[model samples]
Target: MARHAGLQGAGRQRHGYFEHWRRKDAGKPSKLGANKRISDEALLVHIKAIHAEVRQEYGWPKMWKELLARGIRVGKERVRKLMQRHGIKARGKRKFVVTTDGKHDLPIAPNLLARNFSPAAPNQTWSSDITYIATDEGILHLTAINDLFTARWWAGCPTGPPDQESCSQASRSFRYRSANGRPLADNRWR
Candidate 1:
């Protein structure tokens, strides 16, 4: 079309249009690069270095400290700016431990006494268990009878290791409590 207007050679100087396109697209390079304080590679390398040091647990401030220790003459703001640009940060997590064992061979006891914390009266329901306490004398095995209705310890016995007295004490405590009127727990025991 230019040739049709007798301007065949005029359009040859169109290379300057590229400069106009550059100015429009990138906006005349501001004094921005006049101070490209840090190189892209150096900033990324330092960030990765700090991450390796702290296992990625160091934020901008701590990383800044490390940078200073390394004799890097940069300020915290610059570090923060770089880190923010790259979305680098440190955060925390909630700590909880879960433990489960589904392979035990022991039989789960039947809930014969399903949380009957209430008994018609004292000795009507009893819960007994064995625990241990220590004195200067030695480790003592313990057995106790709790009155579900009264919420009181009516009987307790403690003995040293190698003693089979725990079973006997538990039996006697359970008997005495039930003799008052309650039934021996399930009524099928000696």
Candidate 2:
């Protein structure tokens, strides 16, 4: 039938294209103008139907498949072009994070460390800091120690709410865990 139509070796839409859409009841409306007359009411209905079919997640290509399943012999390019013109697009998943404000009326210490970073021996000066860590159980607080001279670290404890007691606990951890016999001072940061 195609050879009889004389579309031999045809590259694209040329002749017999109407055969694909041949329906006795395909009363494809009137020759309305492009903008004012052409309303997407029907197409939008079809797209929304497709959207619901995929739980409102499928994009244009899959939506086009739904149209093609209904004996709608439209080209993929036409569907893609129509979707782009109508601002159809896919969305991405997002992950969220939380932030805290430490600038309230809570008692805060001044930064006296000032990046001085000078020490004669391993245990002579140590810097300690408390931080929060998320885990499978819950939010856990951590206390860490750093020696300024050899820059060695003291393994500390992970707990909740690193308060004055936590700092005192870290001081004891540094005392018992040090190999170098030099004493450490907890002087305020300069």
Candidate 3:
């Protein structure tokens, strides 16, 4: 046991195995009575007040800093623990934004493909979709065209939101010719 504990044989015997065991078994000393500067309940009151004052937008780190600014002496960890224990949380900056308006008067396109993804031959069927990408400059609009049968795709990055011109540009980039050497069907453009 002394060897396992890194204690020399003589030192272990002098200290007594039971005494060493007792000290080792004892857990961390309680800080509740050691520090009498402020009670948790009082600190919690201040935390609640600050939380309300900030409209509940401040998390534990910000809350801790605010408490310090207001002359309240409290540890950050303690504030975090109390806030977590009491279910205090920061609210999101913006409320949910409804991007899509399903009730609009805009004409909805017919589902021509009818969920038939696979085509019998290359250039027989094509699909297109628009998506946005977040970049340091701003949000970039991406327009993509896909040849279903060949599983080949072409993409174009437009300056603003994707529109008819962007789709045409993307299609023109890699438009495969049919048997008569004419552009592929315009169904994908719709």
Best model number under TM-score: 3
Cα deviation at 47, candidate 1, in Å, is 50
Task: Give lDDT tens digits, candidate 3, residues 136-173.
Answer: 78778787767788777666546576566777777666
User: Lowest summed lDDT over 10 consecutive residues: which window, candidate 1?
Assistant: 181-190
Error of 2 at 120 (Å): 1.5
| Candidate 1 similarity to native, TM-score | 0.37
What order do candidates take by lDDT, descending?
3, 1, 2
The parts of candidate 1 lying over 4 Å away from their true place are: 1-103, 162-165, 177-190
- Candidate 2 per-residue lDDT over residues 71-148, each given as its tens digit: 454567766777778776555553454445666786666555567688655676677766678788977878788788
Itemize residue pairs with steric clashes in candidate 2. 112-189, 112-190, 113-189, 113-190
> Candidate 1 residues 77-112, lDDT tens each?
888988888888886653543334567786655676
Q: Model 1, residue 65: what's the lDDT?
A: 89
Better of 2 and 3 by lDDT: 3
